[model samples]
Target chain A: MLTIDSLTKRYGRGAPAVDDVSFTCAPGTITGFLGPNGAGKSTTLRMLTGLTPPTSGSATVLGLRYPDLPNPGRVVGVMLDASAQHAGRTGRETLRLAASLVGVPAARADDMLERVGLAGAERRRVRGYSLGMRQRLGIATALLGDPLALVLDEPANGLDPEGIRWMRELLREFAAGGGTVLLSSHLLHEVEATVDRLVVIGAGRVVAQGALADLLAGSGVVVRATEPDRLAAALRAAGVTAAPTGDGALRVDADAETVGRAALAAGAVLTELRAADGGRLEDLFFSLTGAAGSGAPARTEVAA
Target chain B: MTATTVATTGDGTSRALPEVPRIPFSRIVSVELRKSLDTRAGTLLVAAAVLLTLAPVGWQLTHLTDGVPDFDLWVSSARGGVALFLPVIGILAMTSEWTQRTALTTFTLVSRRGRVLAAKLAAAVLVGVAVMAFVLAVAAAALLVASGLEGTTPVWGDVGSVVGGSLVASALNVTMGAAFGAAIAQSAAAITMFLVAPTLWQVVGTALLGDDAQWLDVFQAFARLSSFELAGHDAQVVTSVLAWVGLPLAFGWVRALRRNVS
Candidate 1:
């Protein structure tokens, strides 16, 4: 299992790259950590795996910090970047070297190479391999220790449809065997199909997080009223979260029926009341992350 | 705790789990050595060092009448070849992790970066020793052939001093190169800085302070080191070594430990 407790990373007194981000991924499931480019997904993963130290808070695997773990490679397989593989060594040599470091039999490396369908290409140098091939090799290296948990960053990038499907199946099989997988990706639909849980971030803060279905299914209602202020106040009084999604619409954290009842009670004329999720999870993803945008969030909103 | 020990689970509860073995220093050293040998660049460096070592022997064989065909001449020639290539090889070994973006994988596998660095240094020193051994073997063979020729004065000048000093001097060169590599991180920049910056300093220093500044010259000290005759240059050797090798090494160690592998 993996847990991130209010982890924050601020470089050189600038705004925190990852601001108070927290989430947990359980065994037997895949948690998709999603964000746009520069949304600090990689930074968060780096901190989680102990590459970059967090400014505050903690990220741990199996209730132990990565560095504190007796042998992290034996417990947590980490692939922060596919492109980070050495370009010099042949694919076979790469696996063999990692195997020796991991104290596993060299045969395991060959097995992994064959498992990743890189058997024929094992003799080729990594410099000649494509980006997708690097990802495969990286995955093979991560699995070399036969770890209980896997942390992959943008593992699906540069993969063909078949390769992605293979990876999805691989992750699925891993999770099915009581393995915990925390993967970060900006590929919405790809993750939407694979992940059991979602942790979406924008501007270094968690915009939304929950089980995949719960986050996408009627998360809240988008209500447009003649007096949005009155409706928002009523929703707030009812302990329902409400935020202006622009265009005179309030994104209310309640079902349509509950929202309708609250609006009627508030005596606010409702011209529009619909589920906030216009389509599938993409709409919710866009709505939640789009509002925060990228880079630094509005300071006034952060202060609030 | 035994190999089978209790570990805390993610749910804030303790459970029994098998303790896997730590990545041993020996394995890491082997890996570092392999990292230095497996690449094309690594192979070429060693091959070039060998060729350069042998090239002088061939030339000396043809131009035998010019000088006494002695062990000193052949040993010194091989030492030059090994010393010249040793630093380049060492720099590549240290900086390739950053240049190839492999530090992420390396550090992730073995979280304690100090161990990796220690392995790199150990591996580099071992490579230096091994290369020096090869150089000596070739030098001895060349000396034997040259001494066999008529009118050639057979001279093994201070075998202990030359062999011992050459080993120490070559190791220092490689280690210094690694320190520069570690401090700068980028391969090209680190190599350029290491190869050029000190020479420029020596030139300017000599121009300004005359021969008095030779005390601060690392290159001179290392050259004199091969003779193992520091009658009056002991302090100079120590001072130059401290200024050139020690400072950069300490700074590089800290940087290696603290810098985030991106």
Candidate 2:
């Protein structure tokens, strides 16, 4: 398991990069640490792996702080940057060094290379590996320790669609074997497709977090009617949160019955109304974290 | 340091965690040694050190005296030919991590930041010592060949001080290189400052301060150390060595331990 408790980091006098963030990842589950760029996902992971010290609070793997563990590499496998491998060494040598560090046999490096589907490219210098190849090599490095927990940052950023699918299955298998996995990403749809749980953060603070199914099950109803503006106005008049999404639709922060009544009062003919699920979660996700745009959830955008 | 514990272990099978032995310091040093030579440039540097040694010995042999050049003379020539190149290897080993942005991977594998630095320094020193041994072996062979050709005995004068002094000198140069590497943390900038700053200071400081410049001229001190003639002015040599090697290492160590690796 991995635990981050009240972690915060400030640079000189600037605002905290990660502000009072707290979360936990249990074994047998994959947690998606979702955020936009500069949302402190990498910083958090860095502090968790003891690469960057937290200004306050603590992040621990298994049962101890990273450095305090007897051998951190053997306890938690961290791949903070896919491109962090040394450019001079071949793919196989990179894993060999890490294997030696963790007190594992050197032969395991070959096993991990084949496991990550980089068997044929093991002899290539990392300088020659493409970004996608590097990501696969990074994953192979992380798994070399045979640790119970894995922490990765932007592991899928450079992968092709097939590579992404391969990574998803790899993570799923790791979790099924009772390992804790924490993977961070900036893309919303990517996380929606891969994670069993979600911790959505914006502006360095978590806005929503729960089991994926539980969070989606309790989300607001999605409604599209003849009068998009009128229905939205009626929902607000009744003190229910609502906002327009990409298409001509209103995501109301209430159940279908309540939304139906509000629409009826507004004298709007409904074309579609139902509980939020799949794709609509994006609208709900945006609403919870406020408007998703070029920057920090610009002004929450709810008609209040 | 608050006490806390999660309800899981590293086995990944819901079983008790197995013992995870800490990586021995020797293993880290060995890995660092391999890392120093694994790169193309690194391999070339060692090869250059070897070739550079040969150039001086060959030059001395071609300009033959009555018999083979004395043992001490050949040691001086070999040491003189390769002093600058030895330190470049040291500087590259220390600076490569930051320049190539591999500190992230390195520190993650062994997070006791200080130990990794210690290992790099240790590996660097070992390389220096090994190179000194190689230089001595080449000098010996040259002396024997010269004596065999000239039909006279090779003079093995002042074997102890002459040979030991050169080994110590090479070690100092490489250590100084590593010191600069740690302080600057970039390959080109560190190499430039390490190779140029002392030479520049010697020219300028001597013109201004004359003999007093000896107190700060690292190259002059290295010359004295390599000649095994520090019978006097030991204080000046100590001061020069401290300014060159000690100051930079201290600064680099503190920064490395505190700086965040992003």
Candidate 3:
């Protein structure tokens, strides 16, 4: 299990890059750290891996602080950025070096190369590899130690469709094998499908966090019917607010059963009547953050 | 598969997980060596060292009369390879981490930032020593063959001084390169500064200070560390060694340990 307590990091004395953030990830589960661009996701990952020190707060992996952990590479596997590679070394040599540093056997390096599907090109220098190939090589390096926990930032940034599927499967398998997986990604749909729990942050502070099911459960409901106006009126009378979703449909804050009963009671002709499942998680994310375009979420200071 | 069958183990017993061992230093060194030696630039540096050593020896053999040249001049010329080439190797080593974005992978594996830096320094020092040794061997062999043809033996003391000076100079150059590489974190800029700055200082110092230039130039201190006399003045080799070699290395170590990898 990984526990992050009141973690805070500030570039200056002003707003922090990561604020008073706290979360935990248990073994045998995939936890997603969700945020938009510049949402402090990268900074938090860096701090967690001990690459960058937090100005305040603390993070512990399996009951040991990062620095105090015995052979950290054996416990926590991290792939912070796929771009972190030397162009001069070959893919095979890259993993070999990591394996040596982490005390893993040289043979394990070849295994990781095959596992990441870079076997044929393992001898090729990293400079010649495409972005996606580099990312795979990065993941292969992370797995070299056969660590108990995995932390990755945007691991799926440049993968193809098939590669993405393989990555998802790999993550699931890693979690199933009793390893904790903490991954950050801007891809909401993928997160919704892959993560068992999620911690969403905006402006450097967590806006919401819980199981995926719970987050979707409280997203209100979307109601669509033939006589939208009548249904809206009925919902208002029933103490439930309804609004047009700008798609010629009304989204109501009532469950499917409640909306169904209301629509029928009001004799409204229904062409479409179903709960909106709260649209997509992406819409909900935007609603919570309220940050558009290049506007970063407000920064909050959290103590580690 | 019933709820009643699921019992909570409240006895507070914990099982220990299997331990993974730490990687050995020999493997670390080998891996670091492989990573560097496989590169084109690494190959180029090695070639440059060999060529630089041979060219001077060839010139002295083909042009000089039938007498052994000053052992000091011969050794000094051979040792000059470190001052000329090791910095490029150092720049490649340090900037390669950043340029290739391998810093993340490196730190992730070692975790302890300080250990990685130490390993890098160790690798660089080993390479520098090895290259200096190779140059010395080549220079000795050349002098032996040349003496066989000329019927004159080379002076041993001059050869010893040249070897000692080259060893120290190579160590200093490698450390300086590592320092510059860490501080700038860019291959092109760091290598350029290593090559350009000293020459620029020498030129500007000569132009501005004339006879008084000796006291003001930092490159003069480095040149003194080389024990290579220029113009008519003798350089304070000891002071040069302390300032150029000692300071840059200390600065690099501190910066590497403290700087954020991201």
Displacement of the residue A251 alpha carbon in candidate 2, Å: 4.0
lDDT per residue (tens digit) for residues B15-61 in model 1: 34347777779989999999899888888888988998888888887
lDDT of 2 by residue, B1-262 (tens): 0012334346442333447677789999998998888877778888988998999898887778655778988887886767778788778878899888889988888888888999999899889888888999999999998888787888999898877887888788888999999999989999999878999999999999999999999988898887788879799999999999989988988898887997
Each candidate's B-chain TM-score, in sequence, is 0.89, 0.89, 0.76
Off by over 4 Å in 1: A220-281, A288-304, B1-17, B66-68, B149-154, B224-226
* Deviation in Å, model 1, residue B95 alpha carbon: 1.0
TM-scores, each model vs. reference: 0.86, 0.89, 0.86
lDDT of 1: 0.83
Extract clashing residue pairs from model 1.
Answer: none
What level of docking quality does candidate 3 show? acceptable
Highest TM-score against the true fold, candidate = 2
Better of 2 and 3 by lDDT: 2
Better of 1 and 2 by TM-score: 2
The CA root-mean-square deviation of candidate 1, after full C-alpha superposition on the true structure, stands at 5.5
Task: Give the winner by TM-score: 2 or 3.
Answer: 2
Error of 3 at A222 (Å): 3.2
Instruction: lDDT for model 3, please.
Output: 0.75
